[model samples]
Target: MRWARAIHHLEALAQECAVMATRPASIFPVRVVELWAVGDVLGPLRDIDAVTVALAVDLPVEEVPWLGQPRGAQQWANATRLDRNPIVGLWRSVHAPVWNHRVERPALVWDAENGVAEKTLAALHDGAGERVRLPAPGAEEWRARLTEELAVSVRALRDCTAAYEQRRWSPGKLEPVADALWRASEGYLDVLDALHGPPEPT
Candidate 1:
């Protein structure tokens, strides 16, 4: 496949660079990272087309079933660190492409056969949201995983690029969403640099 070939070529290039390097080798990051974007609580997502837009923008997104009968929702987010610069993640969502487009919308979020449903999402609620089943592993764990408010803002910006892809944006209209995401990546990358520990003393 094309992707496989691309990876192979990249790996070859890295190997050669490592072999013939005069300068010391720092971390070589080629990992693919996807973004997370959620539109609203208005309705659940039934279409991957929206997600497709996210992917086309060089980031993969997941659909979580939240509103409108659990068709589309915002679910857990997990990004694994790959050698300090690259991270890879898998998104769990409320929709699947296993069936036709029609069936795709309003995707199922549960195993009907066993009558098991997700409790973190769409469950009995208590005032103040103090108690609820959030798909995130656990409350403490989720909090530990979250970077900051700015990171969330940036994630939303990554989701908003769909308008440009759909031929819907006009000069008359503002593009704050797109603008914000660009800025967010800049800040997030900074954090990456700090934690990565200063370019191997060179």
Candidate 2:
């Protein structure tokens, strides 16, 4: 009942803020359709806890003008953390990445169905709450796409490792390098799998 109530509350907030823009841009860079709570609300009771809400927004919060804060240092600082009232909780929930000196927002699959899939994936992976589940769209398609990319990356990493090992004919040096590469590649592949689901067998 708490989970349902929480969802209902978030849904109402999303609707109210859906059309409200924060000066230069909207608080939700993406047109929010889903509000993903970061943790399982139904978990074992604790004295106190914090709830984080990740939104399925149209754009990344970092790029939004009010969020980007190009004018001054104070503004930029505020933008980075998204310390504004009303939706600060949602802003902090979403992950923002930086590249080429610019904060990059999520380039989400914008399709309505994929939006649900994205939220479902996040809940499964982040919350680890199997009871909270939603059917993912294009499961087969995602599997296939990720599979091809995985194969290519794996092959390339293998070749690179082989070449690096060959460069130094000493087993003592080669063994450690090979081992490190193996572990690194495995971890990298696992991350990719987690993001898009495992690649299906050919």
- Candidate 1: residue 152 lDDT (0-100): 37
- Top of the candidates by lDDT: 2
lDDT of 2 by residue, 1-202 (tens): 3444444443444334333323234332333333444434323333213333444344433222111221132342254332332222322112322111111222221123333344533443333434443223366655563454345446545654776667567555575455545644664466366556688999
lDDT of model 1 at position 79:
19
Worst 10 residues of 1 by lDDT: 65-74
Clashing pairs for predicted structure model 1, backbone only: 44-72, 45-72, 46-105, 46-106, 64-73, 65-72, 65-73, 66-72, 66-73, 120-133
Model 2 pairs in collision:
29-59, 30-57, 30-58, 30-59, 31-58
lDDT of each: 0.26, 0.38
Candidate 1, residues 1-202: lDDT per residue as tens digits?
2322322322332333233222222322212122221121113322212211011111222221111111111111111111222212122221322111111112122231322223312321111111331232354433333333224334544554454445445655555444434544554454344333336665
Error of 1 at 176 (Å): 16
